[model samples]
Target chain A: MVENRPVLNVITHLVLILGIVIVALPIWITFVASTHDAVRMTQAPIPMLPGGHFWENFTQTLLGSGLSGTETAPVWRMLLNSLAMALMIALGKIAISLISAFAIVYFKFPFRMMFFWLIFVTLMLPVEVRILPTFEVVADLGMLNSYWGLSIPLIASATATFMFRQVFLTIPDEMLESARIDGAGPLRFFWDILIPLSRTNIAALFVILFIYGWNQYLWPLLITTDTDMTTIVMSIKQMLEAAEQSPQWNIIMMTALLAMLPPVFVVVAMQKLFVQGLTETDK
Target chain B: MLKRVHFPRSVLPYLLVAPQILITLVFFIWPASQAVYQSFLIEDAFGLSTEFVWFENFELLVDDELYLQSFGRTIFFSAAVALLSMSAALVLAGFADRVVRGATTYRTLMIWPYAVAPVLAGALWVFMFNPTLGIFPFLLDMVGIDWNHYLNGTHAMMLVIFAAAWKQIAYNFLFYLAAMQSIPRSLIEAAAIDGAGPVRRFIDHIFPLISPTTFFLLVINAVYAFFDTFGIIHAVTQGGPANSTTILVYKVFNDGFVGLDLGGSAAQSVILMVLVIAMTVVQFRYIERKVEY
Candidate 1:
């Protein structure tokens, strides 16, 4: 607002428009490809505009045995698997992190710092680094091909716990004293006071974690050997691999769209919480 | 730091922290230790024999030409991705900050790609550039350029870099835009009053002021380019076209899972762990310094 030259303003708009186009071009193409039939998609210089087969591809990808002859599970089944895993990861991370953060901040217990550093160390050990051994551990524990395999190993989040700790630290001491004066026990106080107070933090973290859990590729790829256990996100690779034989770009792109829709919807619908969670957790 | 008015010492704290600690131990700690242990031991392909060969695996990795090439390639890839995405984000953020209206709308349009998984990002880009049937290849045909990432190493690397950088733009843009908006308006206005143009004002005042954010983002983007782009490479190239796009993380996964080189892969994992730990420490230190700012 300080100095708005007309030329500069026009350039600014142009540049931003260009940026948006570059960013959205792939999704647009994916959409366009999804709406076309397999015959149209295999043609060169595929249609820039969407085709009329949107519902056909959507139903086939969602309900039918996706990419017939491929060993991958149906799209709806994979979506359900993804939903179950995502919910378990997001909720499980929030639940464990809230209690652990509660214990670390609100109770003077033995080995508290030890436990804190232990959790902190997990930040360095991303699942990508220890992929094989972690797979072995999950397999050894008989957790493979199950929702627990998909979620539990990934749910021990250092960022969420740290975020909750930061939120609890900013809370005034008077709240705890008042709760104590009201004769509320620790569990009661946590359930009534801390939980309610950190509500927005939890929601914000949930927004971020839901996307994270849903988008996970490597972990689920390793453990989910059973086709029924395949998540939609991981199933894209299967479809892509299967495309070597079928070249079913319509169903493949549709599966890709379905895999990404929920997480993308969460981000767009909960943009505020998404931004808050992202910035706060990284900090 | 504990609260000033914490509850009395009791077993409740243990009860509360048990779940996190147990998961951390069983999954994180145990598996990580196993990786470290397996790194030092040589295991045959058939799992019929495991011989303790301390330092041999690390020695082999140090001497291995392919490992060295992968390491150098990873550095190149991360640096390229970080530079491309960060500069793009900085430009868009710089312009977006100038927007007096509909900034949120601009932001919304810019940031939804952050939700797209890396693999899906790869899929989308791969489709757009599918050599035989892609839009880009078709367009390039008129200009006498044959684009086949499947056959060309350089094309494959470029395709992966583009996809990875594309996915990262939303993240860097968000952070850069936040950093820019947080700068005091008066500084820019004062510079404007001093006869500096917008570009000049940004170069002199705004850019230097956001250096800390820039530094923080460099580390963030480096870590991201290192780890988060695995799915992208896996889905797009699978580190193919003669290993042109095989970053370190991909190499680890391929060697371990696909090739079944247990010892070598475990050693690679250990090296990656060290890299992540080093990066995490640097990041935390930057955060501490950022707090002082």
Candidate 2:
């Protein structure tokens, strides 16, 4: 196959190289800028070589952002808070979507389509669209600045629900029927049959939800008024904003890079599931 | 009340849907109602409080220069990105559907940007557009056209739209490509044998087959553009260069969070919610059914 079509293969490689360049250029620049010193960074064309200012820039940023603890921005604590918030969201959304999907697909109950459509509607009314009112609701609920504020409202992801429902619809009907014939209830059948059969899907949804939760900024930023309660992305955002006033390219870039590590790690680790998940088409 | 009790089977679905229902109610429905209610009240656009002066917030928003600019820019940015990205994705996905080898690798790299957070994508672009040492400026300088997003409104919004679209076009490509691959190859083979050239074959056969995914993405991307693109706008332009890049969500952000004009923000948010609901309902009722298999 490789030897059969040299011209076609070359065109493919050429286009792909173009794509790779387009994708990598900005990211590559970020890495380069993160290594340069503050003074040399302002110079013409800037320095591409890794400089000695990484530690100085990172430390100053850490201390300057008051992230060095002491009644100020607790970086580690906030990271933990962000992690906990993201994880809970991922977990809550996954558990709900899986069970809801299993129920909707397998059960012969009434209004299944209604329930399905209700879930689908959220796909349209995404959290951001209703963010203002949602914030007011959170405030009214007495959940503002609490962990629940950071988690609940945005965590019930309709996209995940719809995706899981789509996948659940794909589980062979005979598989469900046969399992039911063996006297398995919905829970038993779901736990014993559907879930095991949907390992690729579960892995896929896990990564998808994890990414979604991790990348959440607006809701978290809106609800958490205190600087001490910031997510990593919001923290980087504040740094980037401040860097605008007092230019610290290295620190901003480094913080941005660090902010990206967890999701990039998620992407790299679950690249397989992601490919399969995105590439899987339903009839 | 103990007259007739439902079985566990009947009650289970409600049980499953309760949390989502409650959360969606509290977050989406109730707040939306508040926003709608609030939008009717009169208030200063920059202030935090409001009185029951009827049908005025929307009227005020209609007349406000910055608000109008944000609205127009939102529509333009959303429509342009959706059209450009969807078409590009379709063409690329069509070509990608053919190659049996390295398809996984292609898919992997293609969807990579979708995973990059919008905030990060925006920040990355901001870095790339840095006036002094940014790649874009450096490239433009190489071409003899000095470019700076910070100094130009058009450049600012253009970069903002492109940043939002870049993260998504590949995602649309992946989904559409998967859909195209599902089209029986025999159909295309038959089209080929029927005296159709590659272009003709794709135009007549493969194109219609993937219309459904294209249509699905059209609405999804429209909703995404209309509602979810604040991170890019905020992080990259911050509605700067004289408010050229300020979209609706960014406006909502600024109004509520930054300016503390909570009622006004809620009003804008409500208007946005109504627009989304109407669009989505139209999609589900009409456009969705147009999708082929």
Q: Candidates' TM-scores?
A: 0.99, 0.85
TM-score of predicted chain A against the true chain A, for each candidate: 0.98, 0.84
Which tens-of-lDDT digit does each residue in B194-230 have in candidate 2? 7776668778887878777777788778887876677
Off by over 4 Å in 1: B291-293
Model 1 achieves a DockQ score of 0.91
For model 1, residues B153-260, the per-residue Cα lDDT tens digits are 999998999999999999999999999889888878988999999989889988899999899999998999899999999999989988998999999999999999
Query: Quick one: best TM-score, which candidate?
Result: 1
**Relative to the unseen true structure, what is the C-alpha lDDT of residue A50 in candidate 2, on a scale of 0 to 100?**
72
Candidate 2 residue A101 C-alpha distance from true site, Å:
4.4
At residue B104, candidate 2 shows an lDDT of: 71
User: Could you list the chain B TM-scores for each candidate?
Assistant: 0.98, 0.88
User: What tens-digit string does per-residue lDDT give for candidate 1 at A113-211?
Assistant: 999999999999999999999999999999999999899998898998899999999999999999999999999999999899999899999999999
